[model samples]
Target: MRPIQNGITDAEVVFTNPQLNQWVAPMNGNSRIRKREGTNQNAGGCRLAVDSAGHKLDHIIFQGGEDVAVSEGKHVIDVTNGYLYGNMMLGRMGLEADEGFCDNVADYGTLSTYAVNTTDIKLLYYWRALYTGINRANLLLRSIDNPDVSISQLERNHVKGQALFLRGYFYFLLVNKFGGVPLLLTPSQSSSNDAMQQPRATTKEIYVQVLSDMEQAAGLVKDIRSVESAGRVNKSAVYGVLARVCLYMAGYPLKDVTKYADAASWAKKVIDLNYHKLASSYRQVFINYAQDLYNAEESILEVEFYGNGTGVYNTTGGAVGIVSGIRYFNTAGSYGYSSGFVRPTQWLYDLYETGDLRRDWAIPPYRYVGEVITN
Candidate 1:
């Protein structure tokens, strides 16, 4: 509860802290879980002890619930950033066994199905990261309404809206990849075996929950465009995501064609808001992304990254350039470090007719220093 009141980001709470980080480590490996016998014996940090009447001793950590709500609100940006990038988004799309790949094509070939095996660490990490967001959101929802909390109605609405959006967004990602997963609305008290083995929900039930959360979020999130930070979700972005969810619902598997109407209506709402539009030059969009120039008239959302020349690699630090840029020595001057991990297919190139401005823009012109490489 001290950790919760202090408002650590979901990642820190799950990975950095001593108590929760144990859940991530395996039980029987060389890296055994440290005994909790003396975990809290050393009192370097302050502790918050409240009597039944609700009197707190630690002033630093036990700030009022309003402050906690504000801290929880900040997690929305970090959670969105985590979801927008990472292996789940890039690997899923990039790993297909396509002739476009210069290397590791076989890894992503039919063999790639093993990448999603239940025991796979990377895939499991994706699931955990999403559930971390969901848990934090649930905690926020539960705590925001406490009688001791003193947030204004507007702040309460904003926090609730952001939490709902994150929960819905994460659930949408899960259902798309793994189909129905256990719908855990309450935060798990401990990572017990029983908690880990909850049964799966139906695909329909999952989507219903996602839609309900997002719809409620839309009603509460207002003035998002004026937030002074483009990284934050606004009303337009909520509607945009809702539209995307609806489009997915209308597709195969479920094939509920009625969702097409919902998709169109939500998309029309985004367009009607006039929050974003087509950039004059399609190529400039990537250029703007490289320069971190968000809030372009054409930009709806952009995941951000930062580099500090750290000795260790930070996945969420936005190192995508190391993956998808121009390959073999960065000839194209693209920031993705041009790993050439993914190349363009000739069929993809042929799809565009002459005078199609986006064809060359979308596909890199690979001139690899005197070699005419054919894939």
Candidate 2:
């Protein structure tokens, strides 16, 4: 067994094909890579490159699929155990229990259906890969040195700084999901020798560490050439992540409440940084319908995952569902779908503001798959 690095221990490491990191999911076996350079559209376009000074990243993880040929194309093949869920981001598949799909609901976002199921092995894979990045971050922060390779002093500092930022990043992920896990700052042994099933730390402690890491990352990448080429980490990315972490910490985890102000501040950083911006259209953020590779301005520090790489997957089935509007399907004045799983909830329908584009397209008659449904 390998030693535990970061708060992650030996038992935590599931040694599979390293390729799994690229694409592992319902569509894993056939995933491919689409490499592209990061660019700056905010200014005269410039390429952001992480010079050799910082430690070399595994580069495998960040190489997530960027090609329409790789991601949107149909050639993707499933290689990992067929979990059938897209490892990419959230989606709106179907809820067999607890929650039911509503006709009035927008086209996507169904993760809450399976959100309560702690038994999801796929969830574990997602978390483990996330922590692996943390482990790498820890190792690099200590030093990017390998007896087999040589490097200049300046490059070493650059790499170390990026590691510090990433270490903070991984911890933030763990804390968000688990609600305060042990702060694993250093490498660990198989026994977790000094740290055995360590108790969950306070959310405050995690927040402190996350803040520290972001600040450190900000300083390290301050002078890097371009936003896209800064390798895996950067200043604006840290700020955006910091804003999100602060939002969670200040809210549900710690009840500090004041953090929202800071959250607002951090969010403002990316908005004002001249680096990133919200896309005019919300849907494009998920699917790469555009030709430009880096949705750089809209996406700050996106986790790279190819369509069907080892441990890599996407949201196709998740994307499949019935979407209707008031203009389309309606019996009298109700909403429903041709689909069995998709039925609208009163709350979802009521939540809409008047004149919203989606409301006019409502599917109605309140019909379930096998029976005539009612509001």
Candidate 3:
């Protein structure tokens, strides 16, 4: 008989630590898989990870999820069959045989079909994940708000700031990806699906809401002198992401050029804080960290992932991973996920003018991955 003293679940009991109730509700809520057709299916969010195979299909099939196709019919689309057609495969048309995926237009020429992949759940995943963190922080703030708990005003404010910033961060992430997402706050204390699946909000409206929440968060955390401020949503992190939101607004469908000054100002604030810098050795930012992620420096803010040790998701993606050779062909000795599958385009490789250094480090070509280039 496990303790359910505060309505904590049995599984929670197993996961609880004597030192910390790490797996309990709010701070750590329940996310057991609900059986589907005798098999369990986790929802598409934090507890639910985006499937890469799905993205691979999305990249290959559709006209382009967040990108466009360069070649005409009977190319990779026709060659791969209509399997390489339709957003049903996750904007299957999104694949271009190059890096930065949709970052450029030149790589649009000779994209051969690689296996299915997925990463763009990005907006939904970050929103869901960080909001989960916010919920945890909120639960702590609210429950500990009694005479019994006696949390100090500053302590309360700290958690409140964390929660508020996380909420802001989550919303910013969502609006970027899905265009607009239903904002969900106030953790449900009740066991119900009653609150899920709310209608979407407008991009302008969500952007406004995000700004409002961030203002509250920025005001709440007065000084940024602590460990939490460094890693998590400290004032600087908030400003950094705020810049991103503004930049995105200016660039894409929004095309609000007026937002540029705000973006530049936010970037300036990050510089003013002296919290981080544009690493002296660019490779050091990614290289040292790939060996042991804790050693990484460039990541001003990052969601830490533990080695599931299941050998799943066991590939370096953003900087190190290769997609083409490994994820699709299951090519042996691939260094990283990006190393395995995603290819760096010749055009991108051309961006460097003689000795810029960035172009070489980034578009280093799949042929350079150690001694594995057998062809």
Each model's lDDT comes to 0.52, 0.42, 0.41
* Alpha carbon deviation, residue 164, candidate 3 (Å): 1.7
* TM-scores for the candidates: 0.72, 0.54, 0.57
TM-score of 3: 0.57
lDDT, candidate 3, 1-375, per-residue tens = 000011111111111122222313221121211111222222221110111232121111122221111111110000001111101112213335343343322332232343323443422333344344334434333432344323345544544565566656656655665677666565433211322367777888778777777767666553444533233345676677778878878887778999999999988987887656565687765464444423212445543211111232333221112233223323343343333333445676676798786764555543543444555
What is the model-wide C-alpha lDDT for candidate 2?
Answer: 0.42
lDDT of residue 339 for candidate 1: 48
Q: Which ten residues in a row have the lowest lDDT in candidate 1?
A: 1-10
Runs off by more than 4 Å, candidate 2:
1-120, 145-154, 189-196, 222-225, 229-231, 280-293, 309-346, 358-375
Point out the higher-scoring one by lDDT: 2 or 3. 2
Q: Give the per-residue lDDT of model 1 (tens digit) for 50-115.
A: 222122111112234443333321232233222235322335454444534434445333224434
Candidate 3, residue 209: how far the Cα is off, in Å: 1.5
Better of 1 and 2 by lDDT: 1
Write down the TM-score for model 2.
0.54
**Separate clash counts for every candidate:** 4, 37, 37
Residue 251 lDDT, candidate 2, scale 0-100 = 78
